[model samples]
Target chain A: MQQPIAILDSGVGGLTVAKEVMRQLPREKIIYFGDTARTPYGPRPAQEVIRFTQEIVDYLLKFSPKMIVIACNTATAFALETIRSRVSIPVIGVVHPGARAAINRTQSGYIGVIGTEGTVNSGAYEQALKQLSPHVDVVSVACPRFVPLVERGNFRSEETYNTVNESLAGLRSTRIDTLILGCTHYPFLAETISDVMGGQIALISSAEETARDISTILHDKGKLARGDLLPVHQFCCSGDPQMFKMIAQQWLNEQIELTPIVWQVPHIG
Target chain B: MQQPIAILDSGVGGLTVAKEVMRQLPREKIIYFGDTARTPYGPRPAQEVIRFTQEIVDYLLKFSPKMIVIACNTATAFALETIRSRVSIPVIGVVHPGARAAINRTQSGYIGVIGTEGTVNSGAYEQALKQLSPHVDVVSVACPRFVPLVERGNFRSEETYNTVNESLAGLRSTRIDTLILGCTHYPFLAETISDVMGGQIALISSAEETARDISTILHDKGKLARGDLLPVHQFCCSGDPQMFKMIAQQWLNEQIELTPIVWQVPHIG
Candidate 1:
């Protein structure tokens, strides 16, 4: 009777997927966990990110969510398969959404992706794009600092503007009609990324497509939570309560209570 | 000679403080944890948050760092006292640093505090401000939604912009020149908040102040870590790693090697 969908991310970024899911599916309650303690899985080695991603999936499984959405590009790249293999529930990631959006929006047949080193290095978006449209060429840049700048609340800072411009400078050499904000954090700099890249370049967030995927999956699998007028959202953070709450409100535009959960690493293999 | 400082937040929000600390203490290395799985400690009851914060503190203490900075408002409000009184090491919260900043910048003779419900309800910021300036008047708003918006990277959305405006609409009647971002996530909405309230209001972020506090505490207590320029960062999440990496790199602007750590909750009582 209680088939909550668990949406987990390193931080608030996952809310994008959660919000979309909320809009797309009114009956499903969501249990969201943002590993705010150790976020930014991008630059880390692949093994480490995979292991870290597993812990969240395992923890959220306690709620016995019917499905799990990675809601992050890095997780999709490194951990989706492992998560799917370890758990019985359906697992999803953001890479497919980004790819789908890129394929749908590109008029010039050229797309660009800007994300953290890990995401760019993993070639997740490129691979996804190739699968969707083999003829389309993708330009990828490792936006190493965009996430930090957005988290620091400096997306509009002159320095942030310059940093984003610097990171995106490569795309200027080629025309890209559709630009995927490959990383969730990149949406914060959407205005900046758009202003620099121009209005013509469509700034697509994978959130909408991710939400659509959840709907289709639920409909096809008969896993949608049944009978809940207002779905409940439970937020968990591993770090401090204050920062997590502040960010949640700013991101979700809803005032929901977040209960802190102690996550002790009793065993790390 | 591993003297890496320990920094923990629910997610990358604490990295703002960590970034400043790195600039201040270039020679020192740091160990950071963002409980990205479960974040936003504001709306929850005090006891739960305290327990959660304590677990991370206890976990990080295993490294035996000289000091620990709970660069989060909710943790400071709920458990900073207990942690400071009981822990062997010097424990600091971001609240005091921002409070000090508010005291210094408040020219209108009136101050406004905005943070998670826990922080405002706990009266931590108000009390901290009063401790510095007993006569000052402080208006506190428990902005529970700000964090989600920032985490979702919706700082520029119509909903987020509207929310910021709604939160600050009443604040203008108070004539407060200085506003403390009371929560780390509020800073992410700086543009919207600043635009809503106008730049005439100086937003005080505790990131730098908290760094200074940690530095002072470590210097005064002689608990600063010794040796090694390894400067490597270890991150852990209670959630998925893919989303974590995206936000981490964008918000923290640093490369980290994240490792898998199991999350266990033995007993809540």
Candidate 2:
């Protein structure tokens, strides 16, 4: 059961979640597959996402993974249930972890969730929050383009910060003390998100929580690659190798030998 | 000889240029193509961009445009020479026009250029400016993800603004009297960029210059569409239609119906 952990995304947005998982589980090797070919499950119809997620999970299963993490917020919302039910190994979704973090961090009992349209629409966050603390008020805003923004590595520009400010204006007025960056790619914008929200609000990222969940599941299953050595991480993207490499360096803050992996995406649900 | 004009980009960044071209050339119809499936060509390698640009140009050629506008800064920098030389119709790059605007707008000798990494790496602005006036001190910085930041409609985030502040800190400290929004998508962040540079430094966008160039070229070639009614604008992309539509609406500030145009992007150069 020492097979590599398989994590898949529609694009590089999921790398944040995968990177955290890699950090927590240093003994295990991670096989990160970014389907940069047809990304952005945020705005697509639910059925299409279900089909796309199933295809990638099915593709990753060929690597004989010990466990799978749906790091993408949209896919986690749309396809997590189906994938978890069908897969033999443990399947983890990011939404619950994000919800738990928000509930823990919020002292005011008000939490804000900002993510892609599909993620916000799925009500996954709301449902998770309510189940954890039925008294907590949840606010969700869909920022469909944030993933591409972070993936493009534009987090440093005045325009990017301004966009973050403008994008969060609606959420700011809500007076939520804790804001959950519900999408994995969004952690890249934490600095800007925090600056806009100022000291009054907390910006919660699911990266660490998701990582913990991965460890818990793998430990329980006797699949933990227990070791002290730093794990070798492989990043594969279907988009331009150079662009992927540059973003991989900036966002991941480390050099990665990015290889192109060609997997025939099966059109199945 | 009257025919539609073709404008192609990796994404909706080109629309600012197209919008300006529309203002100046009211009678001409535009065949606008956004390769949102592979948007944000800034960080990609030149070779891959050439391939992507070539494929999109080939697709746009099916409409038989009288001329083409490489409205994307990254594309203009990397593929202009190859694309212009290969295509039968005239090809206009945004660099020359943007550089011209930067020179014209600067009251002081110091001017700054901000765009995608590919554009900054091509040294297109420095070369163009030196050609125009060697004495002008041009400071160039690569705001790699600004376009995608804009595309994601994250236009007013404080974090996005802070990133802008940090990325441009080098250029702004040099006491740049003027800055060029070298990429078409940058204008959407004009307010943020302007604020970061302080109220003193003037900012220039290439959109107007490109529009004027299109007008001059069309008028000179005797291919200007002459009719009381404006020409129809068609939008196309290589990626998810729903998300692309989200970007188009947010950027264009209007609803749009985009047709999916599948492309095989072998490489960029």
Candidate 3:
């Protein structure tokens, strides 16, 4: 009944985080924004990713939400620090949670990270993991093919498997005990990945961990919702609302109406 | 790592489905048996609860276990037909998994269940809600004092202000969204639980659901352990190292070394 928790991502990938949030915290309302039109932010420049994230945050703040969850790994990698400095409210990102989970799970101290080129190239997961445990051995692989496969909803297909298998072939030799699915979209491919990685390796989902972080932050801040008002959820996308709507309904398992939002240009000085 | 999926329960409470099958089959070697010391086979006479559950299962099938995860709840309730007739390998229980998770998260269901004198008497928290939900538009109160005021492990303490004020007092008046956290364990007092429950209502834990049903029943029963050996686990218990260790260590986290089991003779038999 108070302000909803605002979440934003480059696209539907963030829905994974949203789904977990909904399951773990069913009482809270959510206002989600997906810049689907310009998704695969993994390929974008850091400056551009930060600008887009800032714009979305600006729009989302209008709701006076209790917190903001940067559900996109790339956005978190590029803009989390910037956004935290800009906003007075709490802001959470996926990378740190994912890294922390991976750190906790990996008994071997050897960890593998898979994400888009930008995320892997940015060395976000590697940095975060090392910061937590300086001795952890981090190996990152850029799977530029994954975001496209997920965005197109091509999981479980032979081709998707082939792509994943090929992309992750090198890591097989790494002997890492944990693999961090650095992107939110990766959970949908968990079965395939788990098969490829074997049972011994724990695959940490950034989305799941990020949701856990959100829950902790909310509780610690005393910002958790109390009453029993049925929460109203708003889903907006900068891309095709039809696709977003279909995915939303399927993901949330509830019939949902989606609205399209256009980024407003800031006035030049 | 060979054959082991042994499960048991006492009078119920399956330990959140063996802690989500040790956090999603961390290499498939589980030997679980919940002695609960006396065992809770439900309404049936002790003889029946044991004969149908105990004798048939053979004292937690202490041997090389391939797959056995009864995890309590409905297994003891409705699905006894399937497990009894299905396989010869092993069997499982139902209470742990059931108690671990809320049956259904409702926005307005505000379900209140009365567990009766035995359950409420057991301080199980079930009886308290049923009676309450039926009334206050669906909210229950249990003065059972069974559920510990975990902060101090004192349910009667006046100093447990936040919980007493936020949860009991609020649920007394407002319509609750969902009531998870059914078990009285202090671990349920985690930040995620508090943030998610947001100080109202009652609910259960589904460690399996939390761990995604043990990776979808071990990847659809291909019996999921793959390469990367190093899969060795020993299950031991606190009371009797033989009969209780698997379920105990899985329920409680620690480095456990299991000793061989030899079921004690039944006095009645």
How good is the docking of model 1, as DockQ? 0.01
The order by descending DockQ is 3, 1, 2
- TM-score, every prediction: 0.49, 0.49, 0.54
- Chain B TM-score list for all models: 0.91, 0.93, 0.30
lDDT of 3 at B129: 29
Worst 10 residues of 3 chain A by lDDT: A260-269
Could you tell me the TM-score of candidate 1?
A: 0.49
- Model 2, B201: alpha-carbon shift in Å? 45
DockQ of each: 0.01, 0.01, 0.03
lDDT digits (tens) for residues B1-269 of candidate 2 = 34788998888788888776654455677888887767779889999998888888987898899889998988988998898779888888788766655654465768888988988999998977664444578889999868878767788899789878888888856978888888888988889898888888887787766765565445334465656564567788776767777877766666676654344433322
Sort the candidates on TM-score, descending order.
3, 1, 2
Q: What lDDT score goes with residue B5 in model 3?
A: 65
- Lowest-lDDT window of 10 residues in candidate 2 chain B? B260-269
Model 3: per-residue lDDT, tens digit, A2-30?
A: 78999998888899999887765666789
Candidates' C-alpha lDDT: 0.74, 0.76, 0.61
